[model samples]
Target: MNPKARSYDYTKKTDVVHSEILLPKNLSEQLDESDIELDFQRIADLVEIGETTKRGKMKSSARLAREWVLCGVPELTRAENIELFEQFAQQQSEEQGVLSMVFVHDPTAGDDMATTKAAAEGKSMAAPDPRNIHAHILLLTRKLDVSSDSLLSLGEKSDSELSNDERTRPVVPKKLVGTIDPETGKKIQQGRGLCSNSEWLKNTRKQWADILNERLEQKGIQPVTHKSYKDLGLTFKPTKHLGKNASIAERMGVQTEIGKYNESVNRYNHNQLEQTANSGITSSQQQIARSQRWIDAISTGDAYIQRQIEQETQQEKHVNSRIGQGVRRRAERQRPNPYEQQLKTSADNRKQRATELRERTIIFDRASERADRNARYRKPRINGVIGEVDRLTMKTALLFSSRRNESSSYTDRQKDILEQFANENSLVTGDFREDIRVTTTFFSDADNAQTHKHIVKLINDPEREEQNHSKTSKFEAESDLNKSTRDYVDNESKTSNTADLSVSIAPRRYRRP
Candidate 1:
């Protein structure tokens, strides 16, 4: 009820077919049957009368009585709807420690007179409309205060004294429980007041819908929801509710302004939904085409590489066989001549040189063959690693773009990773740093052989022990002054608000005092 209203006479309307008051179980016996009976005038008088405070001020309008319209669907009978509402009222009374008054109304009850007349004349009567079966639930915001078994009063507390647990005791709207008042520098606490929260209405709607649906399902009827189209993620627009005047006009075949507006909104919503669905389909098709092209390119590249590797292997084998035969013929020619002692020393030296060269050539050939075998086995794995890196890079880019308002620290980390990869491969360009094939080729150059070996060791190490050792050495080389400066800067940033200022002071020459 509005506190400023002149009267609360709406409860006395003729549409109220039945009315009853509900009380908490503990206080049920305290009131007489006549006192507990639903009388709107007496209830209003009780609500308006409040205790005087310590400051000698009458606390009029200290309590609120909220009215809820509990609707019934066509699937429910009038008796079932009344029973459901009664159960809900009792539950509220027990759990929330409040008083409830339920009034059931049937707008179609007037049609019963026509039905009775038709029955007397032996004529059939039309089915009554089921839309007007609803209940009005009046809930008291104040709990009953029981001092003794015989003494009962209305409970009221100052806003400041209300604890976290007691905040929800009153049938008031929820607010920021401990928000401080800027004007008074005091926390705004809970109190007995009118509900101002729109969220409360939404919650009540959902609760009533849930209750109705549960009862419907128990009776093997189709369940319904009370959510709006937008809440349910539906594209359709909902029609506005027509009041009694507009409803009467609409029934008389008149097109109301609201009806025309609703039709326009519905048409616009349908066109927007169609456009969105078409755009989504187009985007999905484009993505599919791009993925197919990538797959074809990868397959073609792998086939070409396989042919190249086979051709190189055959040429290497031919070159190695020729080098082996040439070394053997040189050794045979350099064999010692027992009859010529002078030439024997020279021949022995040549044979020793040939043997050394043959050993070196054989070792190089074995190393090259091992490298070829490793490359062949690792090619697919390398491609997989490259693909994974590409995916990660794209994901990072998208994330960064979406969160452009975020701090630059995240972008700095991405840059650090790219720089490290580039340094490992001895590459000047940071672009394509995530591509494994590009890095491998850059590291395979003759000038970068040592760097390539280090990178290969780093990859095989898995735990990066070598990198940690290098970091330790670098940390040891850092000067104490640099560390102190960094610490000072961090501390100043955290502890002080004022900026550092540079001051120049001349050296003072001290005289005998």
Candidate 2:
């Protein structure tokens, strides 16, 4: 407990704009102590006397009080902030019947370590922001016993000080089965349990956030949230809570380990924001490029049809060189076309992948919140390291499934993004090789029909130049090929044509003979 009014004396402190003590409404008149320090001192002589009217005289060394420093918006004055703390105090009083002291301090920036350090080092720099307006809430754990008419005395532990089970247990009634306690004239029934659990803490935090946001709204400022960054879908590192001593040392320009770490965290969060903004811009550009490519592909379909018609028209003429080449060997057959169906399929697949990635991200955020909502900045939080590791492994498996189902190929950009996501969350994803796999082997017989139709076009030609430019040898070679092809070519032309073979006869005869 903070004694000697050094930290608690807001009335005398220049930075303190206001100070007030809140007493339980239903307590006796004498229980209202104007001096907060006196109530704090009287706590030492307190005794946890059971339900008996006998003169209580034992002293206990239990905890006295817990102090909470309530923060406020700098723009709001002490009076505006008072309304917020009033609701907080009222809740504690009305629900738990506890005593509280509120001290609202004027703006003072204990926020900057760099500027403070520079000033301490005698650098000529502008002063840092003096806007850390906040309040001190000192809550006494012991309730004031009002049974005695003469002296103000400390009583049992406040409802907030009691454990969950202790508070939940049914209180013993003043009169049990028509039996009255002979020690006291009228019996006192035990009070209800106002002790806090995890749910209660969460509600309390939410209530505080709501109250603060309401005050901020009244001042026309932005609101704040009660949830963690992960829960809010914010991808950034969280700052650690530097205790009072570390915070004081930091503000005084004395470098603390946690202070330095917090600065790094701040820098990281800022960078994260910048990266997210840049990523958004890049994604928009990529989307526009994709749409342009789609339009171009659609127009190319018309070009493909036009090209096919030109090829058909060319087939009617009988050019010697054209006849020498097989029909399937034409350049038109080899020309590549952007298959509209394949493009559509690919687009649909990518869209599905984006949806799955988004869903998985949501699930991961929820899982992270469920795992470390309470001690987010603390190591080995709710779900310990091993549990977290296992969750991450499962997440890795899920991510692998998502990525594996993606478009057949993951580009460098996609891989980078995935790696970045995993790194940001401290996750070791499944072996990336497992992401894309060729399940069913695919073979494309792009070559057209090898029917006799191809053979009919394949004309044999002699090396006429070798025979001193003689035309008879070439003519005779062509005649032989023509005669040999006439039998099967006619039948193939009328029924299921396939090219019988390449021009092997002349080449073999020329070589063997």
Best by TM-score: 2
Most accurate candidate by lDDT: 1
Q: How do the predictions measure up, each by TM-score?
A: 0.38, 0.41
- Structure candidate 1, residue pairs in collision: none
Alpha-carbon RMSD to native, per candidate: 32.8, 28.9
lDDT of 1 at 340: 65
Model 1 agreement with the true structure over 52-121: per-residue lDDT tens digits: 4555454664545667777766557777888888877886677567778998988665444444555788
lDDT of each: 0.57, 0.52
With a 3 Å backbone cut-off (N, CA, C), the pairs that clash in candidate 2 are 450-498, 450-499, 451-498, 451-499, 452-498, 452-499
lDDT of 1 at 189: 66
Off by over 4 Å in 2: 1-13, 28-61, 107-129, 167-196, 241-254, 275-513
